[model samples]
Target: MQRSFILLCGLLLALPLRAADPDGKFAVDGVGARSCAEFTSVLDKPEGRTAFANWSQGFLTAYNVFTDDTFDITPWQPQELVLAKMAVFCRANPDVVYINGLSALIRSLIPDRVIRDSPLIAVRHSGKSVFLYRSMLARLRGDLNAAGYDAGAPDAPFADGLIRALRAYQEDQGLVVSGLPDGQTLNALYP
Candidate 1:
């Protein structure tokens, strides 16, 4: 009887500890769900692309609602268009990091401001630890390209094209030409 009792107690204790964190909700960095590694693992498969599409739909909806300042402003872009752009972006940079690409999309669409209600995934830092979202990085690239900043083919990473483009955009906007996407720069670019 004592052995059975001890076994039962042990089992009870172990049960709570066995709980899973597959989506990484308890992650310290808030970037636990669907990691870059996971996204790339299945990137080439049909099911993987489908899963990403589904996730993107949910992500976009959440993002739009999060960034909505008023009921008057429409979402920055349509889901289909954004998805298509992602496909193109993915194809162009086959070796690109998906999380970064996703971040870029978010930045491009919601350049006006970030939502405070929820935390964003895939946060990185510049030299000074300036927090950057992958989507924001992508948005900066696209925006610089659109404004004729000449970032090489509009790829990810803060490369030569992005640097030159940012400088040009800043100069044209007369906003100190810092070549960095600080709050003021984001406001000008998105607005």
Candidate 2:
């Protein structure tokens, strides 16, 4: 499964780049064409989960290639987080195709997409490290401040103040108060 996903990503990366066509129609392929109920039903099986994840990755890769000024649609998100989001969407809209849910997810992620390459920073908390783009951190700081969390300077490195603010924000959002800018935290903050 991992090998297939890697191969898909490689192939996607090698494709000729193109700009997004807002009105252009595209076909839904693979597990993406399945109904949301079918997608949700497959979540319990490992093979099913992997198939959906790979399809989602492939879609996102194509999105990166086609979308203007976008490198990654969800740079800070993990595979599990993406799947979780899909599950939520599927649960809410069981009659829709999985591709529709993916499209909606991509639309929600537009504001948080990485516009260009940026330095990847390893942020450590509780002996765990999460790699995040520098621009993501800056944007996160701005979001925190806008929400009255006051995460110090927007461009500053992760510090005690930022940790405190993240904790406060996480607590307020009813998320895990780990004081780390984890996938879920970032999703909640950005969303």
Candidate 3:
């Protein structure tokens, strides 16, 4: 009985774990299928520019979904920068997986600069100036989330989640744990 149990356990451990959706949720479209050579072939032409712009838009959309709309890096606006980066990566890594090259290019766009001053606190439920309050709060939440702090899900209208995320971020960054969107927290979040 003991030998049979051990064998069964070993077999179960060796078996591959299967997920309900093995392919993942996101589906890559036509442009995503092109090889690095094919993708870089038209970089200097007008058609290439048009195609790259469309492809980059898809990346931006993916970024939004991946970060839950909290990542504010704008790779789509400055098209030239992304195009140049992708071209360079593809050229240097011609034989590399296309997705790996693209991943490097996308990962390079994450912001590195830090905010200088501590901005005013943006309370979610508080009756501060309506527009400025909400916009500031949004930035606070977004930046915190980008810095790897879990600010709850997007579209949540409450303040406690933001406060908890902010507190955790502050602790991680060695800042005062006020749990409010003060300047030091903002600087750390942006940094």
Which candidate's lDDT is highest?
2
Measured on C-alpha atoms, candidate 3 has an lDDT of 0.60
Worst 10 residues of 1 by lDDT: 70-79
- Higher TM-score: candidate 2 or 3? 2
Q: What is the per-residue lDDT of model 1 for residues 32-124, given as tens digits with 9 covering 90 to 100?
A: 145555554565787876777777766555545544452212133344555566766666665655555776766655434433322223322
**Each model's TM-score, in the order given?**
0.36, 0.82, 0.42
Name the weakest run of 10 consecutive residues (lDDT summed) in model 2.
Answer: 17-26
Best-fitting candidate, measured by TM-score?
Answer: 2
RMSD of each: 16.2, 6.6, 14.2
Q: For model 3, how does the per-residue alpha-carbon lDDT over 8-127 read when each residue is reduced to its tens digit?
A: 999997777543365654445655556677678877788866786677767666665445334444412345655666778778766664555666665655553112222333354344
Q: Per-residue lDDT tens digits of candidate 2, residues 1-191?
A: 99999999999988875443567766677999999999999899999999999999999998997778998998888888899989999999999999989989999989889999899999888898788999998888888899898899998998888899999998998998898899779877665
Error of 3 at 132 (Å): 17
Candidates sorted on TM-score, descending: 2, 3, 1
